[model samples]
Structures are given as structure tokens and as C-alpha cells.
Target: MAGYSLERLNFLVVDDNKHMRALVKTILHALGSKSVVEAADGADAFKELRHFPADIIICDWNMSPLDGLDFVRLVRTGKDSPNPFAAIIMLTGHTEMHRVVEARDAGVHEFLAKPISAKALYSRIRAIIERPRPFIRTATYFGPDRRRRQIEYKGRERRKTVKQEQVVDQSSVGLSQAEVEALLSG
Candidate 1:
């Protein structure tokens, strides 16, 4: 315990159940986070994101209004706005491979099954922050010999853009600029 210390991380826990939210908040507090915000559902989560932007988001996948996948997609691809970068972890009860693939495609940083424990949450959070995912974009490299190489997101599908195409401002693409700014700051 000499060198071990809790990380001063900011977190947002989204769940429709009050008991579940409280449990997550307690875990976050035990982990040394001074700030933990709670949201009843995806709509509430989006509202919380607008104000108390979080460094990490742990959201239940079955909420009404927006649901976990929609939230992840909203924050990740920035639908109707700009892309935000806060690490997103989706909580789900299903272990289906297709579900996991869908989550990844929606830009989730990680997926966790239901009944999350403090140890699992902490470990996953540390791993994700230490080795954050990359956001790849296609670009044209003009060297002695002009050439173009497409950057891919590995497993995820992205807009196929031709080489040398001017990069569209992230804000101009999808999610609002304000939402993107909040995500970036988070």
C-alpha cells in the first residue's frame, strides 16, 4: 500500500435502476474518484455529458430513450456533430459475439457483462486509459513518388474516402460541436 494510490478519475455511471447507480457510485468512490455523476437513462446521461463531462463513461445497454449503443454511437461517431474521445464502456447482460461486434462498431472502448464488480471495473478502466484506442483516417502521402494509403480502424467500418480528399472537419461531420468539445475536454 506504500506506493499504491487511487486514481483521481472522473466517472459517469448510467443506469435506470437507482440501486445499480448507487452501487456504481460507491465503487467509484472506493476507487478514489472524488466525482461521480449518475444518470437514470441515456437521455439523462446525455444531459450529464453536457455539463459534467466525464473521463470515463459506464452505461447500461438497455436503457430507454437512447440505449447504450445509441449513446456510444452518439459520442463516438458524433452523429450530426463532432467526434468526442471519452473512453466508453458498455454494460450488457448478453455475451453474444454479434452484440460485441455491434458495440465495437458503435465505437465502444470496452464491453462488460452485467453485475460489474469494483475489481473488474478498475482493471478495465486502467487498461483502457493506459492503452487508448486509435482513431484512423485515410490520407494521401506525397513523397518522391506520390502515393495514397488508406488508414483503417481495423475491425470497424468507416466512410470510404478517396485519397487526397480534404479531411472534413470533425464538427462538420456529425454530432454537434458543443458535444464534441465536451468529449474532448473529458
Candidate 2:
């Protein structure tokens, strides 16, 4: 956290609740981010993405007209998508395992449950920057790799024909002192 900075990154925050959006923006600012765009829902978020060129997107799971899951799918596979490879973090109150799997399958780069703290948010951002997962493309899926850990598989090889692409290179970004302290002390 000593040598890294969030000053250069651009963020887009999409949530139905205005309060949540403001809180996320405030936290981003406190984390040393200087640029953040807000959208009320996923549909509006798509519009913002067309112009904002956001480096990372923090979006809520629940919203009217267009939810986070749908938005992530569009971003990952839509023909009109501005950036299919943009990092996405899904924020939600639902902590159910199925919901997390659903978000992961929809192309989310990270998942942050509701009641989010600055430390949790900062850690998610840090993970995206420092340890970007390679994108996986298959007949039915095209998004960040869903697997978070690498384990030795002693079984048969399934989907050997699937192609995995490295979309984002490993980043050299670091965290701010405040973020480091929050992560360490918590």
C-alpha cells in the first residue's frame, strides 16, 4: 500500500439506491480515487459506459429494469458493448452461495456483499488490479475465469477444447496507506 495509488483509475458506480451510490463514491474518494461516475441502474450504466471508459465498475445486484446480472452479461457479450473486458465488482445484500455463483457465471470479476466497508471495497479493487484473472471463453460462457484458486486436478480433463484467453495482464498497481492500514488492522 505504500507505493500504489488509485488516482489514475476511472470508476463507474451503478446502484438503484442513490445513498449507496454516494457512499461508494465517498469511499472511492477516500481511497485516493479522483474519478467516479454514477448511474441509477444497469440500463443507465450501459449508457454511461459508452462514454465514461471506466476502468472498474462497482454495481449493485438488485435494480429495476436491468439488474446487475443482466448488465454483466450484456457487458461481457453484447455486440454494442463498449468494453467487454472491463473489471466488474457486484455488490449485493444476498450472500447465498447460489447468488454468488450466478454473479460469477455472469462475468463479474469480484463480489462484495452488502454492508460493505471501505476495507472490503479496497481489497476487491486491489484484487482486480494486482491479480487479474484470465478470461475464459467457451460455447456457453465468456468472462473472467470463475475459479479463484488453482488446485491440482487428479481427475479427468473436461472441456479440453475450451480456449482460455489472457485479456488483462498482471497489474503493477498498489494500494494507499489508508487502504493498507484498513486491510492490515482489520
Candidate 3:
């Protein structure tokens, strides 16, 4: 919303299904996005990354050979990842809490259930455009800070980095909390 333009932003849609890829591409185009890249799976996405760095990545969590989790882990933690900070959105059918937690830990910025709607997609895009989250790096993790803004919370902060409060560039390593809020609100 502040400095993002769909027509100017690059998007990478990763899925094993052709129809799903086409569907996402259509939605992106409708939103005025002109640069949309399609990847059949994580491997394909990895290859695409070499050619073009995406501003936003809409990927499915379930796939063959290279699943979304594997992809996210590699992207966020891989030493050779091109753009680790690129916003990642996981579009999947998995609705379990553990699965979502797994994805979040793998560095996914957004989680949208399958059978997605335009409103949900737009909301997520808006959130990323409006407010991106700070990136956090640790001995075992490299990605966006998983914590959301605490208006009021008495819960114990478990992560050792909770007190560090460090941030990295969006082009390097992390997902934005904006992505989660966008999907949740949707």
C-alpha cells in the first residue's frame, strides 16, 4: 500500500498442478501484476530463482521430490538462496496447527488454505505491501520473526532471540507478519 505496485512487483507461483498455477496466475494478472513466474515444484522454483528474484512467492505446501517445507527451509536457510527475504505465502489444504507451525518454522510468510478466493489473495498482498515484518537470524534459524506485535501478552517468551530484537533486510532473510494477518483476516 505504501510503495508497492502489483504491475511492477514480481510473483512466483509454485504448484504441482497446472490448473492451480494457471488459477493463481490469473488472479495475479487481475490484480495488475505483469510479472508472474510459474514453478511446478520447489526444484523448479529454485531454478526460477536463478533467473528472477520474486517479490512475492505463492507456493503450495504439498508437492513431490521437493515439497513446500523443503523449499522454504532451503530458501530461508540455504547458503546459496538467491533472495531469502522474498515474501512467501503457502497455499495449501493442510489445516492442522502443527502443519501450520511447521510451515511457519520453515519460513513461510503467509498461509492460505486451498480453494482460495480473490479477496483472500488481495488481502494478503495488501498486508505485505503495507507492513512487512522484521527478519531474524539465529544459530539454527534464518527467517522472518515468527512473533506478532504484542499489544498485551503475559505469555513467556521462549525463543532465546526474543530479547535480541534484531532485524535484517527483506531482500536477505525473513517473512513478514503482514502475510499472516492477511491470511488470518481472510
Candidate 4:
């Protein structure tokens, strides 16, 4: 981590507030990031993203027109998205757990509350570089896996077998389907 420099990485900062954007840019520059672009809104950010190669995106949640949520959903699910796997970090004052969940479900790779410090920002960037999460696709979601890692977890299987599931769904007495449904409904 001592030798890692962010100068080679490109970043897109999206926020409606000019002051916030500048503040983030300054922080990034101070942290050894030289290639940073600013966007006033998510739409502009999305455009900039297509034209520029961004390794990470630091964006605000609330914005006019295309907000951060919209931008992430499009990027994660859109057919013409430039890079579906681009790492994204949400930096905003909104600290509500539901908002964080929304951001995570929308495909954001990281979340940082407002009043961000240089150390925190640098730590997040380093974490992303060091331990990028694997992407997952499901019937209802498409994004990086949301599970928190357990240290030294060696692929323990947790899924139940088909026969086990079938047994659990039914009963040992071999009750009729209607009888089971009636008992469950009660």
C-alpha cells in the first residue's frame, strides 16, 4: 500500500454542488490522483464515462435529472453501458441504512458518508484495489455480491440438496397435497 499511486487511475466525480465536486477533486489530487473529471449530474457523468475511461466513480446520491441511483442502475443493467464492471463509490451525506442498501443493490462497490477525510478516502481506494468483489447475477439483481466476507472462509457449502428440500417441503406421512395445503393455510 505504501508504493501504490492513484496517478494512473482515472476518476469521475459527479455531484450537483460545485463546491463538493471541487473538494473531492482536491482530495483525490492530494492523494496522488492526477486524472480526475467532474460532472454536475449523473447524466453528464454517464456521458463522460462513455467518452473517458474511469477506473472508479465517486458520486453523490441526490442530483437533478439523472441521479446517482438512476446512473448506477443504467450502468449496471443498460445495454450500452460502457463498462458494467467499473468500480463505483458513493460519497454523500446520506447515512441511512436503507439508502446504503439501495446504493448497494444498485451496484455501487463502496459507500462513504459525507465529510470524508483523506485517510478514509485513501483507505477506500486501497481497499477497492486490493479486494475487489466478484460480480454476481441473479433473477432479481445484477451487481457485486453483497455478502460480507468471513475471514479465511474456504468455500463451505450451505445449499440444501434437492431431496432434502423436497422432504422439507412435504411430510414423512405422505399426506395428500390438498391436506398439506390446508394445514399450512391454517
* Best lDDT among the predictions, by candidate number: 2
Per-residue accuracy of model 4 over 1-186 as CA lDDT, tens digit each: 466889899999999999999999999998889999999998999899889999999989899899999998888898989988889988867766667678889998777777778876776687678766667677778887676444344686532332443322111122234423432342
Q: Candidate 1 local accuracy as lDDT? A: 0.65
Indicate the residue-level lDDT of 1 in model 2. 35
Question: lDDT order of candidates, best first?
Answer: 2, 3, 4, 1
lDDT of 2 by residue, 157-186 (tens): 875765456333333433445533433342
Model 2 scores what on Cα lDDT? 0.85
| Cα RMSD of predicted structure 3 | 5.2
**Model 1 misplaced stretches (Cα beyond 4 Å):** 2-7, 79-83, 137-186
Query: On a 0 to 1 TM-score scale, where does candidate 2 land against the true structure?
Result: 0.85
- Give Cα distance to truth, residue 35, candidate 1, Å: 0.5
Off by over 4 Å in 3: 1-4, 151-186
Native RMSD of candidate 1 (Å): 11.8
TM-score of each: 0.69, 0.85, 0.82, 0.79
Q: Which ten residues in a row have the lowest lDDT in candidate 2?
A: 166-175
lDDT of each: 0.65, 0.85, 0.81, 0.78
